[model samples]
Target: MESDSHDALDRRLVHALQLAPRAAFSRLAAVLGVSDQTVARRYGRLRGAGAIRVLGLSDPERLGEVRWQLRVRCSPDSAGAVATALARREDTVWVSLNSGGTEIACSTRTPPDRSDHSLLLQHLPRTPSVLGVSAHCVLHTFFGGAQSLAVKSGALSAGQVAELAAAGPRVAEPDGPVPELDAADRRLLAVLAVDGRAPLAELAAACGKSESTVRRRLEELAASGVLYYDLDVDWRIFGLRTHTWLWLNVVPSELAAAGAALAGHPEVAYACATTGPSNLHAVVITRSVRELYAYLTTRVAALPGVQHLETAPTIRIVKGPGPLPLSSPRDI
Candidate 1:
């Protein structure tokens, strides 16, 4: 019973951050109806346990960058090394070992001038241990970005959520050309990529800027959709233990419908339209394999215009949604 209560509080706290990533502890406490110290203590415990974390991420799409999803089929002995190499790159955002660790799936972002195929197609396949490689360019994101799977877990009361949502800056739409980053901007992003809620003084010191300058730049980056926070919460805490990535092939004419349908499914964490034979990709969470089976047979089968579907169970996640801290002019 105590465990359940603790997990509930953790979920609420995570959801609160999703609503307002930079909210003060006192604000969170007011929305949660708890003391400020209690809220801070809970956050400390969760962070210490590595059960949840907040990371600032740059939105590649908003920056007019290309994001590609690559699947690598490698010999069992070489999969780990290949996955580690991919994760070490500053471009790769998420890396996962799937299908019992023989297959690796990762997402990488590149600037407009950089060809997306070179890394996965020209490089990876030449290696003897790699059997096959497929790179799918992400075309449309049905869900993800500002959407939080933890929020979909519905851990907070509607009133509380409304109050929390009102506490943060409203997300502004990206406009005009992608903003060019100066040296200080790059340094700021590098540090915030690791910890979104870093103190202003610390950020100022790292970026070699005044606190007010750092504050203004941070707001501009966030408002422009160049940066935002992602709360990496353990889905197990929300009673969703199983994770599966689904690839769907749909008729080109019905692609929008299929993507929209999957986005509305509660089991789906994120869904995107992509290039290749499988035009749609979705990540979903469930309580058990049995529940996953039911979703595949019933809910997934019911989606309109889905021509073919393939599911890969995520065995392990090596890197998460946030990009690793990056350095160097080219990497940033």
Candidate 2:
């Protein structure tokens, strides 16, 4: 489907989803002013059309696994082959091709404090299919949640979408006020923070709350911009080979502009303004180091106010609730 049209339907669903993922069709219809069956049919169609996908996401860091974003650059013909090799690993979770180059990126769940780059990158360039590779460690996920929906779609009034998207939503800051969580909410989060696929009813039972109440609370939390949700796909089975994180230090004045530039690049999977002397931070996933360094020095660093750059190679993840599944924490 055309991205814009697809995005319109996604926006409508996302707005409603932010309120309640498993909301009754009648309730959804009431909000949307449509027939109950219409709500069901539209959602079914949306799922069938691949315009949206709903799944539980886990934080590799918190799951007693290692996590890193691996960057790869490959020959045009070798892209598929490289991806195939990568998909065969047991650590991979996500993988994709970037625009304009044989750029590919992947995320993997592994052990904490294990910096086995050579082992991870081993044989990466062996097939002549591999061009280059780079890996960056993930440190402190500032905001990891559902992607903000498109504002161009007509589903939401332009003003509404803008207001929602413009709120400058933030994630858990180490020193920032840690929002209070009621006993039930904390209980539910504890369950989700461990197993993303925990059943809703099970979670409710665990928290000594009604199923509906638990569901509503989950929705409220998501709508409040405190979580992100998505499906759990194991990419390692698909042959995605690497995971890495690169740390960088750029001129502060041009930080925003540089960050925007990096975000515009399809190569970047995630970015954030960190709390530190370094100023800005980002997570880039790609097929190879060759592609990664090229992007940082060539494409991203080229932005205005870029002064210095650094990278903390993630040896392995220690622990934390990395990101919520398909539901975004900010959506709440």
Candidate 3:
């Protein structure tokens, strides 16, 4: 119960910051119906917890940057070395060891002119596990941060937010047909796109309809796989300060073996099997630098088929989800 209270307060603060990171704490306190000093003191505590991060967003591809995903099959025994190497890479964004921990995945961003293949292929394979790799170039990331939260009250709700997010942008293929959205639904989505988690009553009100009717529409949209409700977490306030992106490369036959071995580590936050030169990508979230070292140096290296490693440290963060179009979460 205590944890929930702290978590709720932190989420409120984070929601406020997502709207404007540099906004005054007094303003935020006023909006939350709290004292200015309370906001300041609470933020200070959150910062100490390592959950609060002041950062900005950058579009690497916009700068003519070269980015790629590496999937690696590593020797389960030496996967830590792979993570170590990844931790050293300046361009690394995130890394993961897939289910069963035999395959490793990573994302990298760098100057378009840089020849990463040469360095990765030649240098990475030499890591202890000894394996091959595959690679993928991400064209763009359509959803991330608060953009993924489409819920807004008044005209929209959590259900609709999920819909707009999953609905995706207009398909641009010569032969592909576009899906149709009714005018009312479209208007609702626009409102939710700005704020998901809105009150159901407010959303119905905005649509000039009954709450039950609006809810039915949301249920239909959700059942269709249009979107999902993923909570926005302000992990920093919880004392989890460390986040690292790692890359690994493993031999083809060793993929499954390596992936399974590394995935069991407690510090790994996200892991996946991706098509790439390395054949795997993952993200590790931890509480401090010491834990990061323990993960990269010992736990990961112990996996099978492990070879090559690199990491990117998070310097700052900028955006996140906010309140729905409604005045409060209870309005629904």
User: What's the lDDT for all of these models?
Assistant: 0.83, 0.52, 0.52
The positional error of residue 81 in candidate 3, measured at the CA in angstroms, is 3.1
TM-score of 3: 0.45
- The Cα RMSD of model 2 versus the native structure comes to 10.2
Stretches of candidate 1 off by over 4 Å are: 1-5, 174-177, 324-332
Candidate closest to the true structure, highest TM-score:
1
lDDT of 2 at 54: 45
Candidate 3 has an lDDT of: 0.52
Models sorted by TM-score, best on top: 1, 2, 3
Better of 1 and 3 by TM-score: 1
Q: Report the lDDT of model 2 for residue 208.
A: 96
Writing each residue's lDDT as its tens digit, candidate 1 over 1-332 gives 12344666788888999988888999999888889999999998877665667887788888788999999999999998898888888888668888888999989888888864568667787999999998899999998877868768789999988988787656767564557888898899888788888889989999999999998988888778888788766676677778888999998989999889888888998899999999999998898899999999998998888889999998777777776423211100
What is candidate 3's lDDT per residue for 1-332, written digit by digit as tens? 12344655665665555443434666667665679998888777765453443332233433456667766677776554575466445556444444334555556666756765664667677765747665677543323322212121112334433433344222123233323447766555544544344567766877776888877766544333242233334454344556666666767677666666655555565455555565655566677889888887787777667677657554322122222212211100
